[model samples]
Target: MDISTDVWGQLALEASQVYLTEGGQVRSPFASTTIEKLPDKVLLNIFSYLTHREICRMATVCRRWRMVAYDTKLWTHVSLRPEISGLHVSSLESLLALISIRFGPSLRYIELPIELITHTVLHELAAKCPNLTHMLLDFSTAMQLHDFSEMQAFPTKLRYLCICLSEVIFMEGFMRKIYNFINGLEILHLIGTYEKVEEEEEEIYEVINVHKLKSATPNLRVINLYGINFVDDSHIDAFSSNCIQLECLAVNFCNKVTGSTMKTLFQRSRRLTCLLMNGCSLRSDYVMQVEWEKSSVQELDLTATDLSTECLIDMLTRIPNLRFLSAGQINGFNDSVLKAWVEAGTARNLVALDVDSSDNLSDEALHRFLSRHGSQLHGLVLGGMPHITDQLWQSVLQLLNNANDGRYYEIVKANFERADRTTVVRTSTNCRVSNYYLLSNYNDLIFN
Candidate 1:
């Protein structure tokens, strides 16, 4: 090794030795040795795998290790869980200070659970982490927050933001801030927000004016909004007009979205790719899928919607590139329509298919759907299809193997991921669902 390498080794050994020799102390495994004696980069590698809490603890162990742990890459991803206690306002400020001082520019992600995070902390974090790209904040209060105006000049480089607020007042300010500040954001997810209703004795139709929200964001690609209530059609209309560049849009459990209004958005936004409309009351007389001049939408998710399967299929076939599809819990989409979807137009590109929670599809229907298209299909989600047995799942896997080249078959339940060049499968006992997870050279399957 070079002199620089040897020097670092010596420093680590001496540091380790000091810790062991301190006090009438109980001797550790390396009581007489020092960190300097160990491989210089070995500890660095160990730091990479540790959680933020573990890394913070290790930073205080010794001066030599502190320097190594202070590497900017160590603080690239930050997770603030509600369950992990001992974080007060002051502590949060101090932690932010430390993080900013040590690795400001490299910071990317921040996760705080819904119940624990306060508005004060949110403001502080927004102020400090200017280069923040991804954030998940769950605020349980109904208070209207100040403009995240502090982040205006910092960097609107945010790509993904997931916010779960309990009250509409909180969203009013938050949305205003986002409209005023982060104009170039790509993917935005808003969930679980209550509406701001009138408490007075005389209250009529409420009009929420979101004209301030008309600014355009050309780069925004995916938008997922769920479990929120909007007062009227205009509010919903204003929100949709902002994200003209949307590709994948998911709005679940939203009470204010009308089917006609939704159809209007589909007509206007030409670049939409994947559309997920779940748990919404789209009880229109008839949902007519509007034709777009430059329709590029491929995947369509109509889980728990009121649209009939025939109506959905009629609307879907309009998009030429239609591929992966999910229609769970749509009582209207019967066996014939699904099988037809699996076999006909652009279905060859249909790699993943989910039909969970549908009382309409039976075992025979599912078997026919899978068996016919099993060769082309890579992922099949049959959750809440209580009629499907383990026997059927096994047959589907076997057929996929027979159809494709001799690639190893992999089964994933609950969640699955791809890392480096390998496939990782993790099963959860939360529910028994039939999934046609396979080992492919492509993307992973994630369900939440």
Candidate 2:
């Protein structure tokens, strides 16, 4: 190995040297010596497979493990998603302090549990983990916070930011600072927020205004906003004009955004790679698939919206690179559209296809679609297609069983990702509902 490799190896050994332990719960030092003497690189590899919780447990086994658990390399991808119950709120501050200091600059990715995030915590992260990049903050339970001073110190390296906030006040308050501080921000996703009614009440909400934020995040590539009632086509026009390099846009469950603005978005954001507008009040004529014929969007989800069957089919046939398509609750997204794609050979490239809740699709259409392209598909959401019978899943399993091709397993695995680090899947001999999960060994299913 080269000199750089040697240095890394030596660091790992110094970081995990086994020492005597007082805990009777741990295996005797001499007993585990064989495992401990392994090369430092191998030991690091073993630690890499462990989650934050598992590492915490391992740290208790021995003095040497405690050191290894705190190693900077092992703290890069951390999750603060654990729910803290029955403990004083001060415990959260302690935990955050420990993580920020011990993890150091190595921490890059973090996912905070809903309502647990606070202005103080974000500041701590920015100061301690200067290399932090991606952060997923859930605001479902987050307290109403309107401070933006700490956010001004946001880590310079921060890029992708997905904040699911609960208050419109907090959402609009932070955007101004986000653009100013997080200059490198690429993806800004703001989900629906809440407000109060009546002037007498302390709680009330106004529409989110991001018009001023354009000056800060001029290079933003992806924008996802949901339920901003005050926004109209003019806001979309301004965003399209300002964020000229936008590649992905998703807006859902909103009324102010008209179909005309969506058309302008489609036309202005020419480099867009993904578009999702679920429940946006877009006129049928404005969002015709023909408008997107020459566009570069690869992933499109227009759930709960209408597009002509002919338009759906035409878009599928025309967009050879479209890899992810979902039309849930949309009319004219029947088996015929799938057939048209199959005949055109464009469905072969699709990684995820969701026609869920499309009542018109029959079992025959799904069977033909799956048989022709099942092996290639990584995700298939088949729920709500009533015409498809239980026998359809059985036959799908049988096909995979006969050929041993593994598509059936892939579909099941794609359907749901296990949330916990340690997941024990138990498959039964007879299941009431079966679409793709018929594997004999549930534990053997590999997660992507």
Candidate 3:
């Protein structure tokens, strides 16, 4: 009475067929699990991962998808910049139409090009977008406006505002208009274009009186003034004294600023964590004279500055929580500086280190530093170092590889040139290295 293997298989197939079919028609188990049957919330979550153009295309699929694609939540943060949006919106009328139709009350943050920012546009944004809180206007173009009275129509609810302006003569009036309007601003970034001038000459434009701004925006938390040559000690003193809640301040490429202001900021701004003073003339005696305090500053960028090694080492001793340090292109950043910081236990919390163009750093000093601290670093920039040989570079890489636990650390950017006799290495995670080159003086190297 025992059944054969073929006979048992046939019987089992017939039994499965009986359950897989009803009314003599075969049916799939997933027939009821179609995409159209998905909940609107799930569909919106899926659409959130799509680009603006892709979301628009998905709208043409079905009625339900159209509704989900056009959800106001999906259009909260919109970038009208041509380079970012990938849509060349030519006219103000078209931009206005898009705002009124697509991104009305749902708009929370927007980046608008300077050309699109007009009186009517500002008025429309204020009237239509009640939830708008962050706005960035790029004025890096050639278009100049003599009057910025239209800024008075800006949304009062804005907390973060960034204005990228080129070298314009009407900075005073423009800034006055902005300060008068956005009194409740918390984060303000005023970026200006950097122009090369002769050493003895100066580019004199109407200076922005930041002292007035500090009074106007009392709730300021973060201020980044890049390439603004007019910002001096008085301006920074105003912000340091008034903006007590300031957390981050960047005055990169502002040559007019010196170490006097740095002392003021450190003493006054107790909550400051990030201080970026790249390309500023911090070579003054005031930098060495200040009494270093145990401050909360975490990220310090002294790139292309003129800080003496003693000053830098003394400063590092005070910053116990210092995580990111950029000391590139500084003449005094030699092995002694590295050794001093490491010995003083200042490099314990350093997660990112940049020593690019520090011509004085030796291979031995770099190798020792990396051997001790390279494993925990998420970012390391060692570009423009002619002193570091290929052998030492390989040892540094080996140390990092052994410590990374088989996880791939991406070489975000690695540029090598035999002409300059320099190697640039920038490392992070989640990207693949593309190109590799061998110089005549250096061995074949591939960063992973």
lDDT, candidate 3, 1-448, per-residue tens: 4467787666556545523345676644544445667789999998999888788799999888888888889999777776765445778888888789888999998887777767788888988999899888777673576355655576889988887766653556666655667888888887777775667765567345667878888888788888886777778888888888888788889888887767767888888877778888886477765545557787777888888888787777666778788888998888888888888887898777788777898889988899888887766777666566767755777666433444343222332332232233334333321111111111111000
> What does candidate 1's lDDT look like per residue over 143-172, in tens digits?
544444543333366766666555434344
Instruction: Flag clash pairs in model 2.
Output: 115-141, 115-142, 196-203, 196-204
- Prediction RMSDs, each to the true structure: 9.4, 10.6, 10.1
Lowest summed lDDT across 10 adjacent residues in model 2 is found at 439-448
Highest TM-score among the candidates is held by which one? 3
How many residue pairs in model 2 have overlapping backbones? 4
Preferred candidate (TM-score higher): 2 or 3: 3
Task: Tell me the lDDT of model 3 at 301.
Answer: 79
Query: How many residue pairs clash in model 3?
Result: 0
Q: Candidate 1: global Cα-lDDT?
A: 0.59
lDDT of 2 by residue, 75-194 (tens): 887666666311122456676766666777898877776444656676778788888888877665655654555555666786777666565335665665555576788767666652
Selected candidate, larger lDDT, 2 vs 3: 3
* Per-candidate local distance difference test: 0.59, 0.65, 0.73
Q: Kindly report which residue stretches of model 2 are placed more than 4 angstroms away from their true locations once superposed.
A: 1-43, 84-100, 112-124, 146-152, 193-207, 226-235, 252-258, 308-320, 335-351, 363-379, 389-448
